[model samples]
Target: MDTKTFGQTRLLKACAACSVVAALLGCAAPAAQYYPDEEQAIEDEVGAALPPGSAIVEFTTNSAAVAAFQQRVGDKLCEPDAQHIAARVRRREIPSEVQQNFRGLANFLSLGALAQIEKLPKTKIAHYPANQPIAFAATAYITDGTCGPLFLQFTPQAAKRYSLSMDFNGQSCRLGIREMDESTQTRPVKHSRWRCAEGFLGIGKPTLIGPDEIN
Candidate 1:
């Protein structure tokens, strides 16, 4: 073949080869991951363990009432009674302080659910490894109407122990976390202890909450 014809032929072959590779790459591309019915998944895996009708409640600044309720609940706080306790708070049978703790715990679980719904970071924070920190901006239904520009941190203390901290509504509290026993009927997802503090709760879990949950 003449030089120009040969060059044209080579060019056409190269273009065809490029097209084939592009097609193969498109075929090899990963399928999008979808978690359909996530809410149901949460209800099944986590919510089922909670007391029936358990949900995120609002937080308030009534320390005396909260403290009193804390004393009343005492060890029951760590038990499966969380849902029952939360129900009392919802019914206004208990003071807001108790609800505040339950709300925080609910929000914490909601944050975990949110993490699964989105992509949240798993990083090392303090002495805890693979901690998750939810930023103020990302705060949503998980906060349960708490004031924003707030940060929520969750750090695993042990096998089932975790810690949560947040400052909202003029009060600061660090919650000592406990996960419900999966084998038990109570099946509470978490139990927490509240200690009052002065300012913003320090960053307990350094893992950042961001697009990592999605990616």
Candidate 2:
């Protein structure tokens, strides 16, 4: 080929390479942001029917609750607004504070966590009434999927009514409950056999909404 033609060809190839690199660099930020939205979409698809204000509370060994549990589970998870009421209970004073704090927790704890979660808007919804209590032993996994047993008790708020929803993650479990009823039990449903998506547990799988409750 002529020298002039060869020079022109090299210039065009260099321009094309630069354009491709620029395009890829431009897409990097958007691609990173898209993953979170993608995860949310997956969660919404799985958790679609979850009533507004519902949340996934993680109580790990690293959580403050571990220390508090030695004193009292109720106190450990108690909301700040509920502290006075919880103190009354520990002091063997009026138990009225117990119910108030219990109700407050459904809103307080959920809202606090939801605030830090991207995309979920905050709301001032009232707590459901205390329904029946469901107690169970669970294997709670870390973000890396390593897990250990955790004994948990879920008490549904009154206004919402109580129903249990479990999404399984191998031997681990993520537990959530709707309104509680007289049927709540102390024995946990066996979760070792169930396989659910990571981050979602109980009957809801990825979204955490029970299959029966979903459309």
Candidate 3:
């Protein structure tokens, strides 16, 4: 090729490379700001969920209550006749405060680590209740594999109602019910219907389903 033609070609290539770099930098800018903003929001929510000086009780894998609850869920999910029920029943949407807690906690873990969290045989329950007993638990599971926690808050009434909340990576669900067999001696004979909302780690639309429907 001629010298002039070669020089022009080099100049064009350099300009193209610069343009590509500029485009990448532009895209990265929003993400850089986005992460910090999200992190701050999460922190604010966590503070609200477990405020300063709030009392909390932690339950390990060995806890009989935790073991029974896990087995109860496992039995339903393993049933051959089990159906993939959509979140719907009494249909209680999760409070914004609870949603924020999951988002904040998950922000600290990567997708791979989240998956491992779900499948771990044991669950760690952190009970923090107001007016009634509230328990928050984390477990590892396979499916969309991720490490996420579940929240269960009981009501003070005689019938005893429960608000079961969970965040699976970005997938979140909150189920509310009047009662579930709390007896530790046996698996629940009857299923509890819950109204739930599913979305990205605490953000989504509400639906209804039985507690056994959660996976």
Candidate 4:
């Protein structure tokens, strides 16, 4: 073969080898790692556990409604009952069947269905502010009216323990690095607190508490 043709052939061979090497390298490299911070990782875990693209809703409220809600649901481990009531009130119109079920369940002495809800990995709560809007985690269904501020309770399925520092209605809900129970109940930690902005709730999904968080 002519010298010029031989050189061209060698160049083509070299280019082909380079292409093969590039393809192999690309395949070997890991996919994009999120490399999220502690809180972000927790949130990502929670988001993954939730239904695809779950919708979060916020409600408006007033003092009277808040007071009534507080009165109806006290701090006696009645998270389930409180959620049921809040769901109905925030929506301003729950199905008769749902209301009947909740009230009927309430009448019974079965921890008022608190255990039932606690057992589940996922739960939602609504907070209603009279004359404002009701806070819903998923969607809104208001029949009577819409006016003030509300909060929703979201019990994560995979998060055993998590902390939250959220700003709702210009107020802060702060907690430290919380623990998750085997049943996936999230509660606050005493020390290890941090200032988080609004809409930041750390959920503890099945994640190896990284070395940084540990140390």
lDDT of residue 212 for candidate 4: 18
TM-score of each: 0.18, 0.20, 0.21, 0.16
Off by over 4 Å in 4: 1-141, 147-179, 189-215
Query: Which tens-of-lDDT digit does each residue in 54-111 have in candidate 3?
Result: 4332222211111112211222222313333112111112224333445434423343
Quick one: best TM-score, which candidate? 3
Residue lDDT tens for model 2, 1-215: 11000000001223333344334333222211112212221111213244454432221121111111111123222111122111000001111333334433433434443123322211111222244432333332222232322233454443333322223333333333333334743232221111123353433323221212110
**Residue range 1-215, candidate 1, lDDT tens digits:** 11000000001123333344334323233432222222111111232243332322222211111210111222221221232111101001221333334443443544444223222211111222223321111111112122222222232323232212221112332221223343632212222222122334653433322321110
Error of 4 at 7 (Å): 80
Q: Is candidate 1 or candidate 4 better by lDDT?
A: 4
Provide the global lDDT of candidate 4 against the true structure: 0.25
What is the lDDT, from 0 to 100, of the residue 177 in candidate 1? 21
lDDT of 2 at 127: 27
Best by lDDT: 3
| RMSD (Å) of each candidate, 1 decimal | 26.0, 24.8, 21.9, 27.3
Kindly indicate the candidate among 3 and 4 with the higher TM-score: 3
Looking at model 1, which ten-residue stretch has the lowest summed lDDT?
1-10
**lDDT for predicted candidate 2 compared with the true structure:** 0.26
